[model samples]
Target: MPKEREWLTFYDWARTYGNYFYLSILGQPILVLNTHDVVSDLLEKRSGIYSSRPRLVMAGDLVGFDQAIALMPYSERFRQLRRLIQRELNAKALEKYWPLHEQESRELAKNLISHPTEMQSYIRHYAGSVILKVTYGYQTQPKDDPFLLLAEKVMQAFSMASQPGAWLVDLVPWLRYLPSWSPGAGFQSTAKKWSDLHMQVINGPYDWAMRNQGLPALAKPNFVSTVINQTDADLTEEEQSLLLWSSASLFGGGADTTVAALSSFFLAMALYPGVQQRGYTEIQKVVGKDRLPSVSDRKHLPYVECIMYEVLRWNPVTPLGVPHMLVEADVYEGYHIPAKTIIMPNIWAMLHEPSIFPEPHSFLPERFVGNEAAVKEVSVAFGFGRRACPGVAFAESSMFVAIATALSTVIIANARDMQGKDITREVPYKTGTISHPPAFTCSLTPRDGAELLSIRT
Candidate 1:
């Protein structure tokens, strides 16, 4: 297995080993599923045994991520966390957040058009603002929000800590028991610092929400508020802990995913102007220039929606979905899968499968148009089975509005050189757990008929 950008290597290996292949490292068996059918067969058809998560000693147990929903093992606590989140984030419950999503996404378009050079920073701010508001009723500062910075720090640490083979403790669990001063024990000190930050992120926002819950001017009906209000006024230690960790899970999972998807969308538009033009045309036809495009206009804007799907397919946010551990030994298609085998679903490979999506690497939204199979299959990009991200509805809503709003407001085109020639596509993507389009300059010229008043929040 490669040290970094494992997804690319996994895709290459899939060509030789076919859909499903296995490897054992230091007696630890790993199963890499490279196609949708295989992932669905095991992760969905046999979800009972495929939903458990692998224990990452360095990232999970050491850095204090084990309590977060994404890395928590399959157990009662995990179920409780899922239930707490699903109650507020489900499609029906998410109706309350539409206004919040639209408000922030509109602000995003306004900020991007005003400060076109800081596209990536504005995108981060937009995502951080949305998730922070949804998870806790706290509003972000216009610039350099402390909560946003803390979340960024936590996510950066997680990306490095959770990466496969990045930390030896994950492979050799015994190393975690070593003292910080011992030789080869430097990770202990790092984990200690990250663990402190993790606690703050998990506790800081939730505490503020609680303290302000009773203040009329400060209180807003949000996930933390709603969860707290529904429960007993004086909660048990377990219940409060559950609420804190679960609510924190929302920001941890939702923010980065939103940033990655929107980043990829901008990159795609820069690379493929024709598709971007088509999307802009669809937006103008469906939603007149009198106002910005809202998430509600999604159905009317089919081409725009296709562009969103294609962006996801072209460069998935989580290229390799979080590893799931087999619950017990089982047989599948004449293969004996031992218990505890780490299941890595190569989502990038599935999205790029030639048979499922022809010209898989090409940026083509038309593939999803009038094609139910292709559309349904792409759902794997979110994840699969019991472990699939519960924020699907929320994710899609935020992404669609952001994409639609941007299309209505600006034209995303490549930057020009000193001689005025279009700078050709060179940088592709940054590889990690969540893949983002490498930084590239894009001109965000305001679209004709789109006025400053239309994007005002």
Candidate 2:
């Protein structure tokens, strides 16, 4: 079994061995790619064979049934789903939703100022609301909004099922034949419940919008409503359910990752004040204290952009990335990789490779400044190959805007310890399928009166 200490385990293995290493976990062949060259070579160059997903027998059989695009093989259906997502979430489409992102971000700033102690929850709410609005054309107002609650529960179930040791049925497919009354059967039941509830929430709003399609366009556009009401097709009920679930998948896949990345940004800022100061100074000089930053300003704000890159590299949210499967047998460096073999790009190792990143443990954004090649290397944190996150444009814009606004307006400080010293280091993290820093306290004080007003406005 893989050890519970995720980064430490991967780091020790990568430092002892070189870039690519293999391990047998629960009778499954697992390959870990630790270097940039190998990751690029396999996931990018050989994408034709490396873009498939490893089979999750339990999750696939009981829950997705090849419906979830993220877990589906590179087939026609996958292509169609990817195309739909691209049309809805690509750069151009994302621009259409900038107003929503901007509005919610402003709300985020206001919430943070009023209740700084609830920063994590507010950040989560903001991200969820943005994604929900884009996907379902609705906003989550209260903290306990039903849609948000369902989305969170579904995500929790997914996270649990995705973990390495979560299910023995994954290792031994024969165990799946056992009766529901048997031990470990709860996972099966929970999987069905999650799947059913997910379909309900995803399809309910879509159906309602379709019935109301003749009305004027909604003040807030929703992807699901647009697709359902606009597209001229005789889609089967199953197909419609699948489409809705796919859109919901975006909410599940995207919200937590974006929120965690932002959280890591704050942690990096608190731990590395010098880098934070440099970013603040750059944003202050370039953007001034007058208005909020926008996507167009990214080019002029390279230093702040580098800080974003460094945060991604410092602690990637999807450390193992969505695992890719090989469709055809292949060989590399005298190693025989068979068809249907599961491959994992050990992104943690790649980003932390000592030779690639000097003082790999430290947070250093300067290395990315004025270095085009370094910036490209950092982009690998999002994964590689054909299945790379299609939401990259949206994610990058959101992070860039949030980071810029925070740096330009607020002072992110570490909470003091009982001994009157900085207690940022005292904060720890919980290990899981998606790596997240444990909740920590930080003070977001306004830099000055003008900045405070700017944030509020």
Candidate 3:
């Protein structure tokens, strides 16, 4: 299958092949876990053996070896990095940063009201700024700052490197031994460029903050500062690099994924105005126009909550999800999974399963609002087991505040062409590791004049 249609193509195959299916990509076993039960069995129940990441030959050899938390084996270094992430991005830590999230989300709403033409860019900036501010104690003011630009370049390179046929080195490990002047040398050189760019982005702000301790008090303490202040005497340079890599991982993972989900949310709103209206009504009833919806008001906004859940389920950011690897040889239902076999929990298949989600193709937030069981089960969008997104709390809170505030304040209308018909319906996604709606126009008029004036200030 072509990369663009990989998810839908795999879904079709999974329907025909049952839950357990395997395909060889360049002589490497690629196991797809199609059902919730199977994914849970391996990723959640047997996490100790299933959480290791499959080695990307090009990435591992060219990039810093064993210096990437996401790609590292399940060793002590991995454990330490994971522990730091869990502490920094956990529920309590997310709550601690709620004020900053709220402030940035409000700024996002104001930006939309002022420059609706830059809606997509603002979304990217908002997500990136929030993560950067929280993770590095630095806020990205100019959207095209050098650090942000380098981050984008790194993402583009990473995406290219991640493509199925991007590098033959992945398939033929022996080719990695070729000299720098070889055809595959570009991949290594690009990887080095990415590493250098990322190191500068990660360490520059940190070094500055270390020199001027307690100088500027932002809304909250950033993750980098917190990590630096933490007492980890045994942290090696390799471990520190891995920690920095994990922070970069958050920007890479959290920024694009959240923006994609929110973009999907807007698309859903345009397609189903009633769902959007219902969410608005619920929020209005609970928290009147006197104040915007805050984290404290989330529980009272069930309809909005359901909408958020549906957005994730409708089109997950990582449709294939981060592939999990087997640490030790294992067998499931009489099928032997060799050690180091690449395991992928096909979240696309699980979320779109007919038995689990009725009319899975449709945009129906009510399924979650009507059925409690579905909400509990739909958590697979984040992934399963130990390797699940550590920033779930932070991501969820950011999305909620952004979505609820946007719904409550703006009148998100579909853009019409010269013929006066919706143009967004005709837009399609450009292919990548993450799916994003192709750029389409939208109007963000404030619901009322007062709301508009408030945003102006």
Candidate 4:
């Protein structure tokens, strides 16, 4: 297996081995689901057995991310956490946060205008700020906020720790018991440091929310506040722990993924000037320059919606999504999948499948325009069945408003070299658990009537 960009390897193998294939690494069974059909059949059709998560010793057990919803096993505890999270993040419940999304979208535009060169950092800040506000009602400082910094640290730790086959302890669970003085025990020290940071991120924001209970009556209730209000003043220990870690899990589940999608959005605009112009024209026609685009305007602006869909399909947030564990052996097509097998849905391959999406490598939003049937396939980027991201409604709203607002206020173009030539000629994206475009030069200049950037809620 290739160390990095394993999705590409999986995509290649899918063509050779048909839809699905199995591999045994040190006696651990692994299943790689490559096609949309195979993924839908197993992950969606038979979700009960395919929804559990395999344990990652480094990320889950050592760094203590097992408490997070993404890493939790399929059990009563997992169900409870999912229910609590979904209660606040579901589509109907998300309507009240439209102003929050629009407010942050305006903030993102302002940040880009002030510091255009730091697009990636500002985008990360935008994502972090929204999730922080929604989860904890903790507003982020303009630059280098402590909470944002803490979230970034946890993401870095998660990306490294949760990587499949990265840590020997995952393959050999017994190695976790090795003494620190022993050889190859270096991971123990690293896990210790990450574990400390993980605890800080988990506790800091929730504690802040608990202490700041004297907000004005008019203040919009956030996830933490809303959940607290749902119950009596006195809470059980399990409820408190669930609220804290579930809120922390919001950052892990939502922020980084949004950053990746938006970063890809900028890259897509810079590379494909024609697509950018088309999107801009659609926004201008549907949503005039009088004000910024609202989430409600999304339905009317179909092309802009297409552009958002294309960004997700162009390079998914997670090439190979969080692996699911198979509970109890199952048989499909005479093939036996053993219990406890790690099932990896090759999301990249499904998005790029030629039969489903012709000219898959190209960034074309028209593929989704007027094709309701095809648009459903793009949801594969999120995940399948019970394990699908709970924040889909929130994520989609954030992306639409950001895309429409950016198109309206600023011009996203390739930065010019000394010779006045476009600096970024290739469409290159960085490889990781979450795929993102490597930092590249881009010029974001204000458009006509740029005063619209000052959007008041």
Tell me the RMSD of model 3 versus the true structure: 3.0
lDDT of 4: 0.87
* lDDT (Cα atoms) of all candidates against the true structure: 0.85, 0.74, 0.74, 0.87
Per-residue lDDT tens digits for candidate 3, residues 1-457, read 3567467777778778988798887678778888899998889999989998777775556654335565567788777777878788878767878888788888888888888888877887888788778877776765576566666666555555554434677778787677878765666677778667656765665554445556664424877677766756855777567667667666666667888888888777877788888998998899887788887688889889889998888877777776788888998889888887888777777888888789997888888877877887778988778888777888899999888888888878785443556854434555665667666667777875326436433
Order of the predicted models by TM-score, top scorer first: 4, 1, 3, 2
- lDDT tens digits, residue span 249-301, model 2: 66666788888888888878878888889988887788776777766788899
Candidate 2 CA-lDDT value: 0.74
Collision pairs in model 2: none
lDDT of 1 by residue, 348-407 (tens): 898998888999878999999999998888898889999999999999999998998888
What stretches of model 2 exceed 4 Å from their correct place?
Answer: 184-186, 204-219, 225-242, 415-428, 449-457
How far in Å is the alpha carbon of 408 misplaced in model 2? 2.6
Q: Give the distance in Å from residue 368's predicted Cα in candidate 3 to where it truly belongs.
A: 0.5
Top candidate when judged by TM-score against the true structure:
4
Candidate 4, residues 141-189, lDDT tens digits: the string is 8998998898888887887788788888998999999999999999999
Off by over 4 Å in 4: 216-219, 415-426, 455-457
Q: How displaced is residue 383 in candidate 4, in Å? A: 1.1
